[model samples]
Target: MAATARDIAAELRERIKSGALAPGKRLPGEPALVQEYGVAKETARRALTMLVTEGLAVRRKGSGTYVREFQPIKRVANRRLAPEGWGSGQSIWSADLNTRPMEVTKLRVDVESAPDNIALALNLTDGARTLVRDRVYVVEGEPVQSATSYLPADLVRGSAIEQEDTGPGGVYARLEELGAKPVRFVEEVRARMPAPDEVERLHIAEGTPVVEIFRTAFTDEGTPVEVNRMLLDASAYVMEYHVTS
Candidate 1:
């Protein structure tokens, strides 16, 4: 008896999850798959398409299909917390944002042009040069979040701010080190469909939604110092915000 598409897809998915087929590794071509699975070309194609829709594989325009790396999605609750005064109260700096107590595996800094939306949020002139920091927040030796933070190059370049690598701290701590204390932050939250790249990077299933957070941090004098956009997989994590009034 011939195996169904679902059966074939399930076998492939198991292989992917079991590490038999590593991420970023290319799967056998359709002709090879057809021969191996004893299926027709159409059946093999359908199986491959199913993998793509499930966020397990990505097909580039000309490049062959590759297994998409699985990135865990974490949920953080959004709540208003008691405002901490300067040099008072426990801060997020004291708590590890890595959640699973994982070490920083990768840190990348690049000079990049700002997207229109980022430019508007940061009040930058169009086509401005921004220092972008890409970090993968890992937990228990696995990637949980992939973050890309943008800043005015003039504010962080050639400073110790870029030197520190790992600790129980965040970008806010680095800003404080630079004498720019962030006193308050305003966050805007929404949900949207994940882009193709996001779908692949996050390893989210089809029809799954993502939470989008836009955060604007302010200095002690109420000047906007930083704007950050965070995308989270809704199924794996939730945002928690505590408020005291």
Candidate 2:
């Protein structure tokens, strides 16, 4: 009896999870898989494609397919903001704050027609072409957060700060560098099951959840400079907020 493509793909996925096939390791060619699995070329190809679609592996245009490294996902609990200077005074997670480099791994400034929700958030005319920035925040060589920010293009197109990479200092810091200090930020957070892609990118295990954080930053004049939606691996971070009566 011949094994099905699903059977082969499932076995390969388990091998990846078990570390038998290490991350960044190149997979054998189709011929090799066909020979080993006793499957036809088409069946082997289908199995490999399944792995790629599932994010367990990637196939580069000129390069062979390689396994992707597994990342540790974290669960974050919302906590009261550290009293003035608390974060600077205390050792929280032993994370190398000084060594962690902030980089803008992605930036897109295209004029995107605003969605209903986004238009309302940015106070834009319906169907207006807004400036949308898709950015990934990496710390210590790992992606810690992914965000998509929306702004009115006319408000920021002339600023170099919008186009340049702001290292170690996220958008907030960058805004300050441009002399538009972010005086306050409002955040709304919620948790949900990880999407298939999010699970793979965040390396979340089965049944683990993800955190969705929506933030709006405003200047002293109460002008909304940015509206950002961040997807965080819930298991990876703790949200801290400050409150006073």
Candidate 3:
């Protein structure tokens, strides 16, 4: 009896999960698999494609497919926004993956007109400008999440929040110093297939879904000070929220 595509995929899947094929390690190419397994080209290709669609591996153009190295980052809702979290110059992310090194791989801050949806959320007039701080968060060298934070232009106009680095604490801390501390937050989450741009940016596998987190930060007086929209690779994160009665 010959090994079918399913059988090949099963063996490869086991290798991947068992760490025999380490993350970032390239897998046997189609030609090699076809020759080694005595299978047709299509059968070998189908087996590899199965792993790609399973989110266990990704095929880089011109390069061979490799196991995905992404580790799901836990985003804990409660502690991440607490004043004591980022306020002490410690990254709120430190709470999520304490020892893993994370990076802000991309940062772009500029003023832009508020889109209608953002306008409504921030109580801004249509076309009102805002200081948008865009960032891409990478864990262990793989991009996991991208975020765009919109702050009233006038509020952070000349503040450190407008700079590339928001100092030691980040935006929330800077907001507090500017007299517009974020005392309360509202967030809405949705999941769907990644958009073309998101797929490109996050390097997600085809058919992989993304988690969108739209968050609003308000001052103690109920004024909306910031609206941050975050896009996360669904397979790369686990959203955590605490509940209390």
Which structure among the candidates has the greatest TM-score?
3
How should the candidates be ordered by TM-score, best one leading?
Answer: 3, 1, 2
Write one digit per residue (lDDT tens) for candidate 2, span 164-189.
44333445555555656567668888
Error of 3 at 134 (Å): 1.2
For 75-121, candidate 3 gives per-residue lDDT tens digits of 89898888887888877788888999888977899999998999899
- Kindly list the per-residue Cα lDDT of model 1 for residues 124-212, writing each as its tens digit: 88888777777655554444455677776667677544554522245566677777766778888897888998777665566667777
lDDT of 3: 0.89
Instruction: Quantify how close model 2 is to the true structure by its C-alpha RMSD in Å.
Output: 8.2
With candidate 3 superimposed using the best TM-score fit, by how many Å does residue 72's alpha carbon deviate from the native? 2.4
Worst 10 residues of 2 by lDDT: 77-86
Candidate lDDT (C-alpha), each? 0.67, 0.66, 0.89
Using lDDT as the measure, name the better of candidate 1 and candidate 3: 3
What TM-score should be assigned to candidate 2? 0.54
What's each prediction's clash count?
14, 10, 0
